[model samples]
Target: MSEPGGVSTGGAIGLVAGLLALIGGPAAFGKAGAWLADRADRRRQSRADGNREWEAKLKAWEAELDERAAASLRQCEEQCAELRAVVEKMRFAMVLILPEVERFAPSSPLLQKASSLLAEILPVAIKPAPAPPERPESISA
Candidate 1:
């Protein structure tokens, strides 16, 4: 049915619907945009929290590694100190015994040569060799 103004009932309904859509479209779009922004903010905060935790763990791991390295360094220094002390004691003993060793060695040119060579080389060797037996008959030529 047409109204007196020649507008049908369906046309009047369509006009009203179009006007409502125009007015409400911007409001609905703004709400949806705000919701999306809030979601993105939440995600960003979550990532930041994860990053902070990772950083803390990395720092702790670094501290543990530093402690281990410091302990190893201290142990190595102790070992070096002990080795120095032993060396010093051996050097003192060598200083006391060297002259007697030379004097008591067999009075032969070959034996003297060997003894001097041994005295020169002993300090540098890892361990001192046992002294040769002191039998005159065994060394006599």
Candidate 2:
């Protein structure tokens, strides 16, 4: 129906209402869209934070492992040095005792002297190997 404005009033009203509905619909959707975007942003930020924390923990564990390894290596070196010193002392004692043994005979007084010397020196010349604990059942009757 024609109105004083020279356009159909009902059509004009319908067109304006349709435009407003279209624009307002998107505006309502914008809130839900923004909420979803905020949620995604929070999830991404939390993941990044968790990754950073895990990286820090891994680095700390690696550093601790390295420190323990270094300490163990140092302790091993010290024990090796002590063992080497014992081996050297045994070698020196063997060197001192051998010539005396070679110069003596099996039944002579000199041989008796050499045997006495060997008995005194042998324990000092050798480092005994560590023995395993004996089982009572394995003992000879």
Candidate 3:
């Protein structure tokens, strides 16, 4: 005999199979989640390693910069000392020459001639003023 409303037992079995598949789908989803977590962990470790390497490089660069700066400062100080010595020598020579020039030139013509000779020979750059006394007011008192 046929079924009562013509629906068969095979349709019921198919519906039960579909329901089972729906219930088991979450297990597959859990595997995908675990794989993603492992990948993220590996990426985190890589980033940490990169950061450490960069930090070491930065420290080394800073040390090199400091060394170069110290060397440059030493060179500048040596140059400055040499320049000071040259200036002192120029001052001593000018002192000796200026007295002789004044002694020889009591008149305007001799003075002009001496000045012209000095300009031609020495080419003096700067004229330093004489230093004032340490305590001028006390000396006057």
Candidate 4:
């Protein structure tokens, strides 16, 4: 139908619809706001989940490093113990050899030089050797 002003009724109805959308009634604008809020919340939750996963991985890596360090420490301790035993054996040998070298000191100048070299090269802990054995000695040469 045409109105007296020469505009059709259908055109007026279209104008009213456009105005309603532009004005944005409560139902229309409210639903859009809710959707935007939901999207923001989802993004926040995703970031939080990612942060938690990263934290867990970091903790696991730290634990692995600690375990490796502990294993290395144990291996070092074992090696040190073996080295101590070898040093003790060397000291015992020096104890037995020094007396023989001293007994033959006048016969061979080479033996006297070797004895002094042994003294200089002995481990720090066994510097003086062990009093050169005792009476009867442990080994006969």
Candidate 5:
């Protein structure tokens, strides 16, 4: 007999039995569960391997870029040194010309301008790289 507002005991038993069969009891469900777990593990391992490969590539690229940047800086410094050398030579020529102008034209504006221009700009002298010490000739006994 059914309760006033709840399932009958017989109906409840039938419903539980149906759910157990639909879910394949224990053995069948266990195999499916194990397969799902294995698939998840494989996927996790694959992702870790992919991450390692990507990280390795990034590190290699970073090293190459650093090397290129260092090489470029050296080239730029060399160019700058050559330019400085040229400027020093030009300054020397200007100094030599100044005395001649003063002797020829005592009231020349060109001499005054040249003197002021040299005085206004700060001269930066670049020191040459020191030569390596010469090894004394070894006396063969």
Candidate 6:
């Protein structure tokens, strides 16, 4: 039905809708702004928690890698130590026995082979391996 003064029903409904928007727009906008602010605050804390988890994982991975590297390095050092001890012993034994072999069997080919090998290898094993070069920073400028 139409209202008085020729106001159509559609016009009255449109007028009410416009009036409601005018009154309610700012309130709705403020409520939405509050909701978004709260959401952002919540997400910020969650992001921090996520980052803490990632940091802990990185620390654990680094520790594991360091442990593996240390284990391999220790193994290498043990092998080198065994090699040095064996070389020192063999050099002593060769020195003690080579002369006896030469005196007993002057023409033995074993003496020649032993002598050549000792000449090549003994000098290296006789001296302690040179100390590693000093760090570059240690030298006086």
Q: What order do you get sorting by TM-score, best first?
A: 5, 6, 4, 1, 2, 3
Candidate 1, residues 47-105: lDDT per residue as tens digits? 99999999999999999999999999999999999999998787667655555655555
The residue-by-residue lDDT of candidate 2 on 1-141, one tens digit each, is 798878898898778656756777767467656887999999999999999999999999999999999999999999999999997797676556555555443346764665566567557443223444667875845
Which candidate has the highest TM-score of all? Answer: 5
Q: How accurate locally, in lDDT, is each candidate? A: 0.74, 0.73, 0.72, 0.76, 0.77, 0.78
Q: Which ten residues in a row have the lowest lDDT in candidate 5?
A: 122-131
The list of candidate 5 runs beyond 4 A from truth reads 1-25, 122-141
Error of 4 at 31 (Å): 1.8
lDDT of 5 by residue, 1-141 (tens): 787768898998788666756878876567666888999999999999999999999999999999999999999999999999999899887766666666656567877776778767636432223444667678433
The TM-score that candidate 2 achieves is 0.56
List model 4 lDDT by residue over 1-141, tens digit each: 789999999998788666657888766567667888999999999999999999999999999999999999999999999999998898778767666655645447776676667667764432223244455655644
The best candidate by lDDT is 6
Q: In angstroms, give how far residue 78 of model 3 lies from its true place.
A: 0.8
Better lDDT candidate (5, 6): 6
Residue-level error in angstroms, candidate 5, position 79:
0.8
lDDT measured at residue 126 in model 2 versus the true structure, 0 to 100: 30
User: How many clashes does the backbone of model 3 have?
Assistant: 0
For candidate 2, list the clashing residue pairs, or say none. none
Pairs in steric clash, model 5: none
Candidate 6 per-residue C-alpha lDDT over 42-135 given as tens digits, one digit per residue, 9 for 90 to 100: 9998999999999999999999999999999999999999999998998889877776667666667877777778878766332212345567
State in Å the error of residue 136, model 6. Answer: 68
